[model samples]
Structure formats: C-alpha cells, structure tokens
Target: REHEPLITVEVAVQLTDAKKFFKVPRTFRVMVCPGATVATFREVVGQDLAPSGRVMVPRGKEAMMALQDSEELPDKVTVTEFKGKRQVYVKFTMAQCYKVLSLLRGHLEKAESQKALHEAAIEVAEDEMEYRLRLSQFLMTEAYPVVCRHFGLGCDGVESLRVIPAGMYLVDQHLELLELQLEVETLMKNRGTVNFLMGKINELRHKFGLPPADYPPHLLNFVYSQSLLS
Candidate 1:
C-alpha cells in the first residue's frame, strides 16, 4: 500500500426539508478526498441532488425541489458526529440544495475573475512596486468584496480607496504644474488635459464619497495663470 493513491472517503449527506424534518432520512454517498473542505462536499452533494432533473431514488414521491430557499442554507457547514460514526453529515432540502449550487457557481465565477485580473495586472505594471501596489489594491477593492459577498459578510467595498488618500492621484499633476511654473514655461498653454485628469480624480472621489483633493499652492498659482491666459 506504500505507493497506492490516497484513499477517497465517502461523505454521507442526509436529505431533509426546510422544516428540519427528515423528509428523506436516507444517507446519500459522495466520494471525495478525506481532507476536502465542507464546501467541496456541499458542491458534490448539490450536484447529486440536482434540481429539475431525475435522480434514481426508490420512492416515487421523492421529487427534488427545483431550487433551495435562500434562508435554508447555513453560512457555515461542518461535519458532525452521528450514531458514533466518524463521517461527514449534512441535511438540506431540495430547495436549499439548488440554492447552494447556484451560489457556488457564482462564487467560482467571481474567484476566477479575480485570479485573471491579478495575473493581468502584474503583467501590465511597469515595475515591481507598481505591480505590488496594483495587486494589493485589486485584492482589497475587488477580490475581498467578492469573497465577503459570497460569505454574507458585511463589506463596504471601499477598502483600497480608504487606505489611499484622494490627493495621491493628484500628486503627479501638482508636481508637473509646479515644475512648469518654476521654469517660467509657457509652451503648454491649454489646461484641458490637466482639467480632464482632475475631473477623473474628482469623479472617483465622488463615486466613493471621498473628500475632494486640495491643490498645492504652486499648482493653484499655475491654475490661476491658466485661467487668466485663457
């Protein structure tokens, strides 16, 4: 048995109705890795208890519900002891099972999207610092919310913006204007591009309910000069 594959275990899930009554007291067997998480078994069992499809059950009245009720599935599922056997056990109404399947599907899609975006962001970043910052921002702003939503956790979904001040985005704009002013440069007459970038910064701030960024003194002078020149 030394080189044998890891033995798979049978997880028993008992089917019940929303009322916690043993509508179908029989245990259904699902094969999975011994160390698999409860979520894994839930998915396996959910598929076996597929809604809107026929499963081979002896009793003719054992019709699976087309979907699960939202209130039926618990936030966390764990293996509990039953009749002195060390086996995983769960109970779900047909409606609850369907709901679980739908939720799992949506969660998988969101997780995949997060992973794709993270990889793409890393590739697109110009330097290591940019990649790290962008990755962290994506995780906090996008991935964290997706996870929180799936787990029914309270999330404001503004974690990244909360950590990064509104003025940070405008810092480069302020510096550029200051440099132009100190050099007495007048080659860049139109402030349209600067205004557009500022507009975007303000739009982001408004969307997230963040305070408006204040202009640095030198930058303010440049804006004043532009307005007079225009």
Candidate 2:
C-alpha cells in the first residue's frame, strides 16, 4: 500500500479551553497515504501542532470521532473531511489549565458584583421615591389646610396661592405662601404709617386756612384699602 497515491486532508487544532475566551481555532493541511495507520497520522499532525493530544474526525453533524491507534486512514480521505472542523483537541498542561480556570472564576465574580450593585441602586431609588411621596402627601393633606386657616384664606385662596405647578413639590408652594404673608404684613404696616402722616398734613393745612393736598387716587386707595383686613 506504500505505492498508493497521497491524499491531502485538512487538520485543525482545537483550542477548547482557550476558545472559550479567545474564540478562534487553528487549522492546517497535510498529505498522507491512505494506507497509513491512524497512530502514524496522529504522530505526523502532533509533531507540527500539539505534541500531546488525540486526533479526531467528524462523526456526524455535531459529534467528534476519536481515531484509534490501530485504525487505518480511509482510502477516500479528503480535505472536506476536516475542513472547518475540530480535527484534534489539544489539552493544556496542568498549570495552563489552572490559570484559565482562575481567570474564568474572576470574570464570574466581577459580573456578580456588578449585578448586585445594580440591584442595590434600584432599591435605593425606590425608597427615595416612597419618602418623597409620603412627604408630599403630608404637606397637601395636613400642612396646607393649617396654613390656609391661619391666614384666614378660604379654599379658593389656597388654590390661587400656588405659584408652582401641582406636579411639583408642595414645599416650594408652602414657601411661596409664607413669602406672600410677609409681603402682606409689610404693606399693612406701611399703609398705617402713610395714613398717620396724611392725617397730620391735613390738620396743618386746616390751621393755615389752606385746602388739603390732593394725593394720587391710586396711592390714596392703596393706603386705605381694607381687603386684606377682612
């Protein structure tokens, strides 16, 4: 059978463990006589690729068939038999295997840690929303009514007093109401002072036998208005 014609066959070195990380396989080609024993073919392939590994062939669609030492290479062996196939799976030495395992473990741990942090952030956001909701409810239902009663304002006044949209936080509205109260108090004080001064001026005009000074209608009305008092 030494006179048999040589056949070319494709051979790929399987990166099994490394492929899980790198995802690339290695392939090459070799010429062999059909009469050669599987062991001899494996030796020839191993010498060029991995010195220590088993040679295999495609069994079916998804299975690899390991070639036995005593078996002979099929007479019709062709490149298509091993093309894009995992022809030989090379096993890493013990040390290399351990290093790959360690890397895999670290990657898994990091993924778990990231997932845990994401879940924690979601929980914190939920809690904050709940607190804001509770605070807003208290301001609207309890605090707002009390503020309205204190200022002698009716429901319409409370509605009109909102300077911000209803969707916004009620705390800002409460602050705006307090500012309005302060402004009202200041206006009342200023009006009283103006009235007193005006009365004194009129009295002086009367003693001098002159007519009272005519102030602007808007100013007089503003100083004497009683809307806020009611």
Candidate 3:
C-alpha cells in the first residue's frame, strides 16, 4: 500500500522571556505524516529551540489569540486535524510574543499614517470645490442680475453688453470660473491616488493578521459620490 504524503506546516514559536533572553519569536517549517500525533509534532519543534521548558501548541482558533487566553493542543490530537491550515502558533509559555508582532506593527503604523494624509487631501479638495462652486453661483445668480439692472440693460442686454465696464466684471468672473473648474478637475483625478493608498492600508492590515477596519460612514462611502459642479 502507498504511504500518505508528509504535510508541510509552519510553526510560529513565541519566546517566553524574550526581553530577558534577548531573543525574538521564531517560526519553523516541519514535515509530518498526516496521522502524526500532536506530541510528535511538539518534539520536532523542540529540536530547533533552546531548553525553554515545555513546547505547547494553541488549539484551533485560539492560535490567533493571546497565548495566555489560548488552550493548548491535546497530545492525542492528529496533525491531520490542522491539514488545511498553513501555520500554527506555539510557545514555551503564556508570555507575550514580540519581535514579529513589533515588525508587523511598524508596517501597519506607516500605512495608517499614509492613509491619514490621503484622507486629509480628499477633505481639502472637497472644501475647495465647494468654495469655488458657491462663489460661481453667487456671481451668476445674484451679482450678475444686480449689475445688469444698475446698467439699465436688463437681463436681455447683459450678454450683448460685454464691451461695457460693468460687463467686463462678468467676463472676469467667467474666466475665474473656468480656472476653478480646471483646478477641480485636477483634484478629482487624484481620487485614483487616494484609492491606491487605501488598498495599501488594507494590505498592511492583513499582513498584521488583523480583522477589517471599521471605517466611519463617510469614509466607507465613495469619496466623490456626487458631481462637484452639481
């Protein structure tokens, strides 16, 4: 009869007294037969470590939790129980795991910082767009009609009287609106950059072995949902 193939699994070992021992947590890959007992797996992991007391594996979902709150794997449990899992967490004691966590935390921090900057830029862009829209509306709806009445041209002559001094103000306002529109277009194009940064933040979070972030409604929704000009 053919024998079952060996399964390769990653074992992440948490050092008990990392600070005192001046050592960091470590991970090792080991090959074990499908039906191998948990006891056998622990022995194999111990061979690569120092004389750090007992080697214990966390049970099921507890592997992702703090070591102190996690239950140890039973000696009679078969390695095949974890066949689908790529990595397992083990430790010498219930103490905290450092080193690897610290490195991942550093990466997460940087990603969060970059995301913040992108969010700030989006807010500024939205504010500037709103300001320009308000000014343009005021000039067209309120100021333009009042100027036409003062020049005794009424609404009909307003467009034909562009050469007059009063009409020049309307012309200048139109040019300003065009410039503002261009600036808004440039800012809207930056939405792609903001999306790229958000992707990086989520990627880093996953690498840190964290759950999805709970963003506020405004952030969770699309940054530019409505037309800026509208």
Candidate 4:
C-alpha cells in the first residue's frame, strides 16, 4: 500500500453550466476526526479511502460492504499535524468533499432564511425629532404657497420666509407694520409691558414711599411731536 502510486483520473465536466458556475466551489474543511484510525474506519462497509492523489474517504453507503472496498482501495492519505499538536489531518476523495459541502449548503440556506425573517419582523420607529424635522421640511418646501393659493393672494415668496415675520407680505411697506405689531404684542406680554409696569411700581413704592395705585410712568414729551403739534 505504501509503494502504490496514486492513479490520476481524467475528469470531464460539461460547460452548458451557466449560473451553476456562478456558484463558486465552496470548501468544507474539517479536521479528520481523531481516534477513528483508517483500520477502525475501514471496518464500516462501502467506505474505502479513494485512490485519489492522497487521502482515503468513504466509498460506501453501507457499513459492511464499504469496509470490503477499503481492502482493495489502497490508502491515499498523508497525515500532517496542524501547527503544533493541535490536530492531525487526513485528506478525502472528491466524493467525500461533496458530502461536507452539501451539509454546509443546507445550513447556509436556513441561516439566510432566518436572517430575512428577523429583518422583516423588526419595526424601527421614527424618532420624535426626525418626525418634526420632516414636518418642517414639508412646510418649508410645499405647504406655504399651497396655503397662499387657497387664499388667492398670488404670493410666491415662501423660501424667503426662513426668517421671522415671514408670511403674507406684499412689499417692504408691510414690514414696518408687522414689526410694530410684534413690538406691541411683546410689550403687552409678561416679559415686556407688564414686567416694566411692575418694576416701576416696585421702584415707586420702595424708593419714593408711593403706592402703586398713585404712581404711573412720568410722561416725557419728545421735541418732534410737541413742535409738530405746536
């Protein structure tokens, strides 16, 4: 068995194979399961190490008949220990290579199916800020003019309104009115006129010993208005 030369066999494969070639030849490597020597392995039927260049693999589907085949199927194995004392190696025939690859193919398909199902089941929610930003984008991009169209103003200056006091302006004349209205509103609020009034009352009551009901802001007449009226 040791002196026997490995017989080279010619392999003939047809090329009508189109998409099948796209599926690259996948290798399913595994360490030879130790403690199962070729002798003990040969005991099983239909399992003869093939006469490939090296390495013997099963040629049997049956436990009894395969061992008989191995007696004639000289050993083609060349054992190599990987790295240090990690593992012993034994090669297999092309037929055995197919067996391992078949198992891998099945497992890979199942894994892909599971991954797809997991992805489908997931329901990622939109964040609050993301939704608000989308609403802002739609308003800035589309809503303003559409609303103006509803009013029949023939307005088309939505993008310009990125600043405040933005809507429904015919020209620069409206800007001063809008500014005054904003100032009036602000002065009327708690942070404006109300606050100023309260502060003044406090100053009068504490510094002058005058009550709030008796004190109001002292009026200062501007020269322009007074002179004009005169």
**Candidate 2 residues 1-230, lDDT tens each?**
01233354556555555435576555654445456676756544443434345567777887777666788765322222232322322222223223322332343245553354334335445353443344344335534454334322233223422411121222122333223322332232234445655665566566768788676775577566752121
Rate residue 51 of model 1 by lDDT.
44
Q: Say which candidate scores most in TM-score.
A: 2
lDDT of 3 by residue, 1-230 (tens): 12234354555555444473676444444444454444555544443433333345556865532222123333322221122222222221101112212222343245553354345445556565554444344334433344334323333333422212221222122322223322232333334333454554456556767675454455334445542222
Ranking by TM-score: 2, 3, 1, 4
- Which candidate leads in lDDT? 2
TM-score of 4: 0.17
List candidate 1 stretches off by more than 4 Å: 1-126, 158-230
Quickly count the clashes in candidate 2: 0
Candidate 3, pairs of clashing residues: none
Per-residue alpha-carbon lDDT of model 4 for 40-135, expressed as tens digits? 332221122233212333355622222232233323332111121111122332333333223323432455533432332232132334433443
Question: Candidate 1 lDDT, tens digit per residue, 1-230?
Answer: 01111223333334334774746444423333334444444454444433433222122455422212332232223222222222222332233323333433354346564465446544754343554455445546544455335323333345323322221222333433333222221112224444555555566666668787675665555455524232
Pick out the ten consecutive residues of candidate 2 with the lowest summed lDDT: 163-172
Worst ten in a row by lDDT for model 3: 92-101
RMSD of 1: 20.4
What is the Cα-based TM-score of model 2?
A: 0.28
